[model samples]
Target: MLDLVVLVSGGGTNLQAIIDAIDNGTITNARIRAVISNNQNAYALERARRHGIEAVCVSPKEYADRELFNQAFLDTVDAYQPGLIVLAGFLVVIPPAMIQKYEKKIINIHPSLIPSFCGTGYYGLKVHEAALTRGVKITGATVHYVDEGTDTGPILLQKAVEVREGDTPQELQRRVMEEAEWVILPEAIQLIANGRKEA
Candidate 1:
């Protein structure tokens, strides 16, 4: 079984979906060990608590430097001994040490089909706004392995949603989130677990 540690920074709709999938037997042979967030008030923590999972907050503000913050983050994650790390909507840039520690075990869900509208400045509403302004007929979500670079990892899965002519950013975001919560997260985790077993 894969022991998962989910990291998030905002409303944890995707996190909740993962919990539901595990509870409902959609993704069997796996378990969520903990949920950690950088934001103290993130609703993701509440979701984790609701499921009787350990929830922790490791704010960067408490540390003097990025290295120290990342070290603490690594310690927190290591305490759970997670076999897989899932970034639901985490907003921080993880340090190289942490990346090296987890390597291919870390994964992220992007709001847009990557290689088109994804990078440092593109997140949340920004991605949707860019897609709407560009008048793209198709916009979607991507699940990828997390490398040191910003959203520049090997793609695992992607699902496109048709963009209507007059679709607002909120409209596009809603559709993208639906695809993310319902399909991408579970499938990506399952793929990663299976790949690890094969390796």
Candidate 2:
């Protein structure tokens, strides 16, 4: 079975989805090894602990530099020997070294369609706000490989959600997250796991 290290910074809805998938055999060959968060108060950590999985926090404020933070993050994740690194709502900019080390093994679920409202400063509610402001008719979530660039990795799977004329950012985010949890994340993980088997 593949082991996953999930990183999150807020409410762990995506993390919860992964756990549910594992429990229900949707992700047959995987188990969550650990969950890491930058924020001590993040609910994701609590969820991990509830599931008897190791949950840890590595605050960037504790490190003097970005490289140091990245090294520390790498060390923390390394202890679990994770086959895959899943970024749910993790808000940190990963350094090049860690990205190179993990390469295509790291995957992220972005709140918006790629090559659009994605990049630095485009996360959480901001992504939905941008899409709504642009008067887009369709917006959705993307699951992609994580690279050095901001959300500019190879796409694995994407699911679209229609944007209603009177929809607020919060409403759009709600629908997008629902699609993310039920469709995008599970398909992405299955793609990687199946690819590993092929290799």
Candidate 3:
């Protein structure tokens, strides 16, 4: 079984999807040990709480600086001893400390097909906006290992979503989430849990 610690910000649709997958047996031999968030108001915390999973908020604003906050966050995650750390809409730039400790153990769900509308300065709806601006007919979501660089890690699972005619960025974003991100994130975790994913 994969012990998971999921980190999130905002509404946590992806987090909720993982939880649902666990409940529905779509993701086998995997359990969420905890959910952590930098935003105290994040609904992700509530989702975790609702599922009886430990929920923690380590707000960066409470710390002296970015490094201190990163340490605190890392400590919190380490306490859970997770086999996989899932980043589901987590907004913070990953700290070197956590990256070094977790290495390939951390995975992230990006909203774009990656190598396309990814890397630094591309996040949230901006990724979808870039795809629309570039006039790409196909854009999708990618589940990848979290490396030091942004979205440059070896890809695990990707499901493409067609960008229909006159599709707005928001529409494409929503479609990607529904058609891709929510689906692949859990599947990748399951694959990892089942010893199917490569190192």
Residue 118, model 1: lDDT of: 94
Worst 10 contiguous positions by lDDT, candidate 1: 190-199
- Give the clashing pairs for model 3: none
Give the root-mean-square deviation of each candidate in angstroms.
Answer: 1.5, 1.6, 0.9
Per-prediction TM-score to the true structure, in the order listed: 0.95, 0.95, 0.98
Pull out the clashing pairs in model 1: none
Q: Which parts of model 3 have CA positions greater than 4 angstroms off? A: none
Best-matching candidate per TM-score: 3
Per-candidate Cα lDDT values, in order, are: 0.87, 0.87, 0.92
Candidate closest to the true structure, highest lDDT: 3
lDDT of 2 by residue, 1-199 (tens): 7888999999899999999888887887788999999999999999999999999999999999887888998999989988899999899887788788888889899988888899899998999999988999988999888888898989888888899889999999999999664577876786676664220
lDDT, ranked from best to worst: 3, 1, 2
Candidate 2's C-alpha runs over 4 A off are 196-199
lDDT of 1: 0.87
